[model samples]
Target: MPTPTKTGKRTSGLPAKTRLQWSGLSLAIALFLFPIILPISGLDGPQSRMLGIFLAAICLWVTEAIPLTATAVGVIFLEVVLISDAAIVPVGADATSAKVYFASLANPVLILFLGGFMIADGAAKYGLDKNLAALLLRPFGGSARLTLLGLMSITALLSAFMSNTATTAAMFAVVSPILKALPTRRARAGVALAIPVAANLGGIATPVGSPPNAIAIGALAEKQIYLTFAGWIALSLPIVLVLLLFSWGVLSTVALPVGTQLELEMKVDFDRSRAAIWFYLITALTIALWLTESLHGVASTIVGFFPVVAFLATQVMDGEDLKKISWPVLWLVAGGIALGVGVGATELDKWLLGSINWQSFSVLWLLLLLALVAVGMSNVISNSASANLLVPLTLGLGASISVDQGTVAVVIAIACSLAMCLPISTPPNAIAYATGTITNRAMLLMGLVVGILGIILLAFVMPFYWYGVGLLPVN
Candidate 1:
């Protein structure tokens, strides 16, 4: 018989993960009960209850004791039971209707994201993503530095439309041959690092580019500040381009030798089938409509449903494709929306802001604080969750301080996407780390520099630019 061997790492006791879950869950529960069991000084009953929900949400989202979506839905459920009109213990007759909480699932922003998801998934299903990558990279030539630039540019462009995680995965597949042909592991690591960094930066360019953007938009809509698709691109695309080029420079200096050559090859085949043709047309038209929202005056959310109708009507994307959409992301965004509604309706923001002296805090310093907090939290938690927690608070601050609601929301959203310090920072980073081509130390080094640069740009440089361009409230 084989001898039983003893491993030093927790062979008999509860697993580490299970223990973490229980601890996190316990902390969340205690937070939820704190506001209710011991009332605060100035907050009323509804405000106190909503405060508990918000606190608990922060704990649950940061710890991820439950799935992110589960925590999201749990927030909505708690709002309905504790603060809404359907509350088991009524606060007052002014409680919001339960339907208001439920409406978050079908919020207009989620509809817009649904449309984006369909187009992105359809691109993957029809091979448009890879073909586009191949077509676009042809212009960059065969030098290692130029090839790196091309790879990042294409990845960023794709990520602007598709999800960042999906964009990173697709781009990696397209560039795997190049990665393998590199003579040094440093070159390979540099090439690999570019994809995720670019994807993370690219996600700030448009409203549907990532979950944080959508969350920011949804929160802004509640405050009567709307941003069109084209408007968002106009606001953020410059930042994306600058960051992309900066990251490329960092990677090139660190990884590629002065005169290295790279061989590049890609095969592009367009689908000419009837369904594919219709999908292609619909995709183009939908994008055109989104970009021209200023001219047509149709809300982006209304235009968002165009593809849903066109694709299904033309049989371009069937039921299976519909089922494959990133529903969890949509639900997560919805939860954020619901949380915003509950907080606003219950006057929780007013209570939270009441304690702070906004008269002494300059708008620049306040914006700086929000951006820094967003970057730090996002590096350790989900970007969307960080944005979900921060955007609404920033919106509330607009009324109390001399800040532009739209500018602050956009700042927090962009900062959330800027975090990429670890394997767990974002899905794109995790994907790159999983490939075994890049080490954690390398990612930390690169991600830290990029994140700090981004924060500096956001706090000092971008605000001045926005002010010059009339994007911010001129003092």
Candidate 2:
């Protein structure tokens, strides 16, 4: 009955807005509480509850209810104050040190990831990624579909050596100029979306392609499920090829124009600069080190560190540029590892797997179900955390089902990397969305379709191919 405003807007009380905000907050609180509250009280002890709380914190970060960095800090606080009665001690001590908070920080995998990022940052700053993209795209003869294929292949290849987010960002630097010079918005958007999809798809080609892959590899190694370089490649390459072709087909048929002309000048210096040569050399060494870990016993971290040192020593990138690296992402990965370790330490993974009913399903069906769950969870959580949480669970579940644990672990890891449903699902997708070329709705729709197809390939095709080719142990 109150009079309408000049703009014909209804007058709403402050109480109403406050109520709505409180309602949302309450819903979030409920979600955080439900897992712990609904479960049997004594079945999961304090450690298990703590793990659940850690996971809930990650979920809050992924959903943007809180900043991811802040969530990591929250994890440290929770671990110290609530989880254990153990006293804090100095760093460089044996077990039971205050450095426990930094336990995951010292992991070899983390060191390798940081070192790799340094190298990638150097490559990006030195125009190596741009040059590589230009070299690859230049030969496509200006056909949009062919150009799309070239972009996908190049991005995928780069992904094997670099972080998927970094690879996608590099690809964008090259492709954005081309898109801007195009005449139509539709063509620009199509190419823009294709770039990220390609980057994500390409990331499946190597163990170091994405965080999820690294997590899986590290987790399996801890379980003594060792896979050599050739072994992993034998399993991954076929899946990667099939998925890459599928992604290219989807973009060509669904989004991209058949006969679009590019008006931009493609000028790139393909000359091998000193820095580029050094980068290539470091990359080759890293790959060699990873492949020959058995003979040298040289940790991958040591191999990765050489590139970082070379980049700095050669003056390829300055200190300020290094500071701009994603520290929050590093923290998130650290916290995810801590939480994963905590889960195993507390035996929550075993308890959770024990509760699941795996009796009725075949091993293949169980693996497929796990893959679907990994894909869905990765969409809502950071893929690294998804991998951390699920890999151990998959291992335990596999034991319960009397199937090979390593096989289930690898499947979950791969599926975690396949998340493409939303920008928040993976950093590469977020990087692509930030370019302003693709709408959220378009990305979501296209990603959902692509993700479904990817899951299908992972579930039905990959296991057979891996086992048939002698890459994976047959049951």
- lDDT for model 2, please: 0.70
The RMSD (Cα, Å) of candidate 2 is: 6.9
lDDT of 2 by residue, 1-475 (tens): 5557789887752333345444544555676567656776544445445655555664555555565666656665555544444524221222233356556666666666777677677667667777877877778746777877888889888887777888888888777777776666666777788777777777776666777766776667656676654456667777778778887787677666668655335678753777667767776777788778769877666676776677678766568867977667666666666665555555667776676688888767777788899999988777776776677556666567766766787788778878887888788888878888888888888778877877777777777777776667647
lDDT values, one for every candidate = 0.90, 0.70
Give candidate 2 regions above 4 Å deviation: 1-55, 80-101, 180-185, 228-231, 255-264, 270-280, 291-297, 313-318, 434-436
Q: Could you tell me the TM-score of candidate 2?
A: 0.81
TM-scores of the candidates are 0.95, 0.81
Clashing pairs in 2: 89-98
lDDT of 1 by residue, 298-383 (tens): 98998899999899999999999999999999999999999999989988888888788987987777777888899999999999
Give the clash count for model 1.
0
